[model samples]
Target chain A: MINSPERVAPDTLARVQAEIERLGFRPSRAAQSLKQERAGAWGLELNSAGFGRLGAILDTFLIELTTGAAERGSHVVPFTAADSAEPLPAYERLVASRVADGFVLTDTRRDDPRPAWLEAHRVPYAAFGRVWDDPGITSWVDVDGASGVDAAVRHLADQGYERIGYLGWPEGSPVGDDRRSGWVRATTDLGLAHPEWQATSTQSLPAACRAAAGLLDQLGLPGRSARPGRPGRSGPGVAIVCASDALALGAWRVLVERGLEPGVDVGLVCFDDTDIAEALDLSSLHQPLDRVAERVLHLLATGPDSRDPAGGLLLPPELVVRSSSKPAGNRTTRKEK
Target chain B: MINSPERVAPDTLARVQAEIERLGFRPSRAAQSLKQERAGAWGLELNSAGFGRLGAILDTFLIELTTGAAERGSHVVPFTAADSAEPLPAYERLVASRVADGFVLTDTRRDDPRPAWLEAHRVPYAAFGRVWDDPGITSWVDVDGASGVDAAVRHLADQGYERIGYLGWPEGSPVGDDRRSGWVRATTDLGLAHPEWQATSTQSLPAACRAAAGLLDQLGLPGRSARPGRPGRSGPGVAIVCASDALALGAWRVLVERGLEPGVDVGLVCFDDTDIAEALDLSSLHQPLDRVAERVLHLLATGPDSRDPAGGLLLPPELVVRSSSKPAGNRTTRKEK
Candidate 1:
């Protein structure tokens, strides 16, 4: 038996409106053709570079999106570069066949070539993310990485830590760069300088750990005295904020092992508060994935140029303070373990 | 700048053929109406019933499956039961929309109603698990829960525990039932009667701890000479094989607090082998989710009417013995910290 509305998610009621809209629609051409013929016809298109979890994430999201379309009495045929060595040919063929209505595009680079390609060919499509150099694209929804980063840094600053440093990601990644910008802006507001102590780390946990140690080591010596009354209380009580909680957790482990109390002597924060953050009790900024997913789906549903080009939306992130960002030396700190 | 074919997901490539056919054939009048007025479309359908991590896993599989479609330059729309009060409506609407060319379904319950619904409507779709009863719908891929349970129980029993009890989920869940049956079969074969210490718990960690204690209390003091056994061998070495690693960890916490060493004096085993399992060194069964996802996607891409008379496909599970289920009285067992 199904439970009450209170027990169910809020999204459960959206179908009624969709059903209402469908009721007003005319009979499908496919239905007429199927009655006259036996074969089913449908089309699907996909294009992107593959990265493990990323590829995995994109695949799952697409399949799920398509499943609903299928239930609505449509037959979807999937298209991808997997069918051919070159993605351009498959894409062109779908458009040329006039069998597919439009294309769905993802992995759009900062200076993506596809938006112009699709537009020049007069094909209506939606983008999973935005392309910076191309302004003529029709519709697109993207995660606002800058705002997410800003939230992470702001939370750390609010928690009373000075001399914040950002453990950055690989150079030139648009998303990573945006997050790093947030960190810089936050630190700048406090009139703090970016020290050479900050370092870069790849996504690996051990790499993040090393980067964390590198940052603190630049402070020079575990028991060293701060340079007199300029008053940042410089010994070890520095805040280390990182892009992606993965690096943060890695850095956190290193701090714990170094005999420094987290939240007291050292502050650690990470972006993207995922399951790992919850498990390790790492302080982090939680990105609104649901909101992002909804926005992306909305853009994908509607063609590019369907919405206002000048309007961009940014969702706020929540900060959850665990042992990693709290002031150390308190008795409650030791008891947390 | 996004690299194409060399970086594409290979499995997704295989399904692009069907998309090619869809793009090539406008088919009949019904097909034309079903075709997009502007572009190709597919979607992600989030079943409204259980919207948690398992749901995420299923969603990810679908997204991965569609990677081939996207690469081929087709569009898919992800629509879920977020608005539908139930999963059945989402399934039904997917069939009616005429917007999707294919469908992907998952989180099949023990007695699912969606399979028959899909079959009756004749919509081709893939399922992640089999419904225990239906003969009409045929096509599903699932993890083999029984063998996983069998392997875990036997491993624990081999680790010098004479009598082990099955600490499972409620008596009815298909996964739980399958695992418990395996546990019972294994223990009985090893010449131990099924003990009455069977207890169940819901989602809470504290509740699971209570369940463990209650189950042990039901055993009626194993050290007494009430039954045929050696003096003071008490409590069957008390190996509690749990349904999931999360549940096992919950019960283990309770065991530790109650003067019993989890890996030594009291045995524990869990399923899923998630991140926590490795971190806590909990012995567990590793179900190959990545493989299961692949097979599920393959079946969906191939038309979803796989294995006949219930369309069942079983995948193997492996046993990973950690410190959590060590032999009773092992040197590694800490003396009740």
Candidate 2:
């Protein structure tokens, strides 16, 4: 009767609820689960390499997911795979034991085995990244990196930066290529295409610095004198858009070493508005993590088949403008005012 | 009979186990919980301010805890308090619903209500930080910040640094004060007491930079000529020990702006060997998170009564040597070799 309040009379229901509150009575989760045939929990696999490192966004997403799960009268069970390369065993264990009713997947990559295994087993799951191996799978929500970078490029152009260059990761990574495509698209659209102006590096700081230094040389930035054989588009109006905050830090360090101010000497922007970006006052793209978490939960609750026929949701990131994107001329004019 | 193999005949047990494995007949967790009267899960509270920020160690700790719990045939349920200041209600909710058998606490602070509330209710719990409110509470595993800072100060002094300055957070935080105390003790012990050389700032980069810059000016560093009437201790042999990686970053920026390289120009060390420290190559104190996680799980399983009467555990942090702690003179000698 208490479980189904509608079955009781209104007056009796109120009286019984008051008495239960007075007695501090509550049903045990185990008993409730046994009756409901559900775990009331979701399994989240933690791959140390994917998160818990510096400047990773998954930690924030985990917090949001945990909070949202609690609000929806469920709990999040965090676990880790003994072997990250083959994580199906861990997922299978959780399912076999009935510890979780569903799973939330992250760090999605090409040739990933998880989506196929879950689908074959008829288990419910939702991914935070695109299910790269299967286009038919729409149970995922991811931030559109390409559109985010494009927006950043357009933002720099609007700020009057004529010679815009890109500092990005090595080609072949899906995310890296996605972000680079945005730069290519935006620059081509704006009639400021300089395909030779960009440089690639690994995520390491030193490598990024070396790459950024080389890119700066190609663009003829931080030096007023133009190279004899290179293009004449150089100096204060030049800007660089990085694929991530770590890459931006490298570029920022190089700019600092050359005695150049980020906004005044040259405009700068990067992806993933992490603390590094905020600390350095660099412009960046902010991922809509809260919306992503909400959508993932919604997909898990309402199976993919019950959802709209549309494909995976790709939300555009919002551009966060800071002092790094402001030109020196604009700052001087504002000061004069 | 399968649960208690000793009660069954050897041949019967083997045959039954084989049949169970062949059929993949694993017992349901909900049914097991109903029979065992335990949730088989531990609750972990996530306070956004306490973690999920840049350069925080809590995210790493969560991963370790999750992995440890799984090894012990348990799960960790992460939740958020609706009201962080008064988290007892959330704890009570979990207890009333029996969603978790015990709780694992983090970010323990002075006058913490959770310990007292848990004690009153006889709920098992363990903390990652010291339970500051009551001396009798021994269910905690904490990193000795004071000893870590002390070791850092001694390391700088051993490196032939004469004027060692301290960069720390504003007073009143228990953890910050504990770390600060180590610097005071170490400096006095080493006959290099200069209490006046310390500066405090919040965790923000700009505030830390301002504080660090002011401290450097007082020490007369980054300049060859000493200020008239001031002590002549400003030179390449000076060093600074910071309370955290964030503060060290501030001091690093100041040094970079003045064209002074870390280790070679000024020796530096900070606590929490986070990713920022590794990326910047700064020497830092590494907390033993794996041991901490193992101990926390032990406490949860054994309960407070089964443990030794000795107080809470305090593990010392290990110092990770990197380029930031090496002296310029030392590097020059190595180059000559």
Candidate 3:
């Protein structure tokens, strides 16, 4: 046994390998790699407690990610971080223990510490959301929230309503800012500019309702036309664009309370086409999570030794128009605003 | 060096161990156990594609389970099962590869092949739902759906609605049947025995809506008092206990269409207190999933060689009352039904 070629006879090694293959006795990842190769899993650190209101969206994204990874013969190892403020300890443990080959980060925020840690450790990873302040190159796949609001503006414009109002989350959220930028860009191109109709608040139903109330009250009955050649028309017919379906739900309730018909009097658009949007029959932007998951895996598959820099992908959001954005009639009704 | 105790000097071993501890250098789970003691992970198989409309409820349950597992110092390795019929392949791979020490199974059904397979393999595991037909000893933690529905029925009875109806999923489903049986037991106890008032259908909003419509039509108005001295009742004065919140949402819509006030004219109760229930303000049965998860982990911690037989737990569901089940008035108004 000691004098065998390379510690084991070549013929014996080949025979054992063949028998192992024949019996389909697959070896564990650690045993197969001699503890040097892939862990055969991907890490995902989640703030299980922090996703309170947005848990549905995050869960759907995770499901998609898991399905995509399974198709590629991998598993997603979900670990919990005590809180969002400190998520690095779990990632550190995962990497140090070689529990996963790489990771897929979600809920990326400003000055996020995860990307830098992974990068410094030479670990392969891809983020589902973008870090706003990070200048470093990284792999990420994000849906363009701004373009979603822009499309909503165009859709409402095509329906003959020009005065578009924005109801979004407060100033700091990268996602909220991106969505608000879409409204800004779309309205600028259309020349139906009414900047003062914009409103901002926290990402909650009550907060959105209060912000929507303020915007609607300020956007009260249109007295004069903003666009030229439409003197007969009242002020820009108002359409409210929200950062999320939750906000849109609140905005819809506000409209109902004010005796203003949603599809008839005001156009409402919500981002993140969740079931709430479907139940409420509100127009919303649906992110193609399956496609996003596919792209994320493709990016994360790059090994740490790869020479190429980390990649990035921005997917388009599909706008689903429901009764909330349906036109009441021809452009002639613009005067009724 | 050759004569050292256990192949290493005691002083050297102690110094190295102290340094490792001081550096907080978490050795890989494999290295920590001489690569044998524990995998430090648990297997959780999910059918991302098949959940469809019921995905939200499952997602919440998983989140709670993840939190509970994290508290116990373990990570959840989520994998995708192609379909419900064949969830064994993933579990087998996980166990044979030693990727996970054990599993926490969910969505267990009648004649489930999982428990038997795990038993045959002598793999440590516990199921979140019970096996209806399995006589073998197994560990499981399940919420009593029947008891949940019974509570809903009783809550409605106390609110002055003696003539209660039931809406549930079709027969053959262990969960659906269990929930339906609760309605049976509770109504029988209250002496409001109207078995004909029960309805069943697939679990969906439209399907439940159709079933609710049919039940409402069949139970048009109170012809004669099932109870004495309620002749002045304007309608049947019935409340519908649903197998799930999805069904309750549909029933609530039907009530709105029929111009019947949910809280005043009719009572509504839904099982599985999902966010949809909270959003629509319909009372529902809230399962204590955190406790269930903790129990599941405790059971799974037991190895196959343990002397104790497999354990089972049946936790009660708590009913949350919302505006949907408010009392119309005292028994004096019972005649109005």
Clashes of each: 91, 0, 7
Model 2 off-target regions past 4 Å? Answer: A4-23, A222-236, A332-337, B1-23, B222-236, B332-337
Task: Give fnat of each prediction, in order.
Answer: 0.17, 0.83, 0.42
What order do candidates take by TM-score, descending?
Answer: 2, 3, 1
For model 3, the stretches where C-alpha displacement exceeds 4 angstroms are A1-24, A49-55, A196-203, A206-238, A252-266, A279-281, A303-311, A328-337, B1-11, B14-24, B32-34, B49-55, B213-238, B255-262, B305-311, B328-337
What is residue A247's positional error in candidate 2, in angstroms? Answer: 1.1
Q: On a 0 to 100 scale, what is the lDDT of residue B215 in model 1?
A: 67
User: Per-prediction TM-score of chain B?
Assistant: 0.72, 0.90, 0.85
Best by TM-score: 2
Mind giving the per-residue lDDT tens digits that candidate 2 earns over A1-337?
8869989999999999999999988899999998997898889999987787756888889889998888888888888999999999999999888899889999998999999999998888999999998999999999999999999989998889988999998988888899999999999999999999899988778888889988988877633234222233344388999999989988988887666778776789998898888888889999999999999999998975685469889999999998899886566443210
- RMSD, one per candidate, in order: 12.3, 4.1, 7.0
Point to the candidate with the largest DockQ.
2
Summing lDDT over every window of 10 consecutive residues in candidate 2 chain B, give the lowest-scoring window: B224-233
True contacts kept of 1: 0.17
lDDT of 1 at A278: 57
lDDT of 3 by residue, A160-184 (tens): 7877898888887788888898988
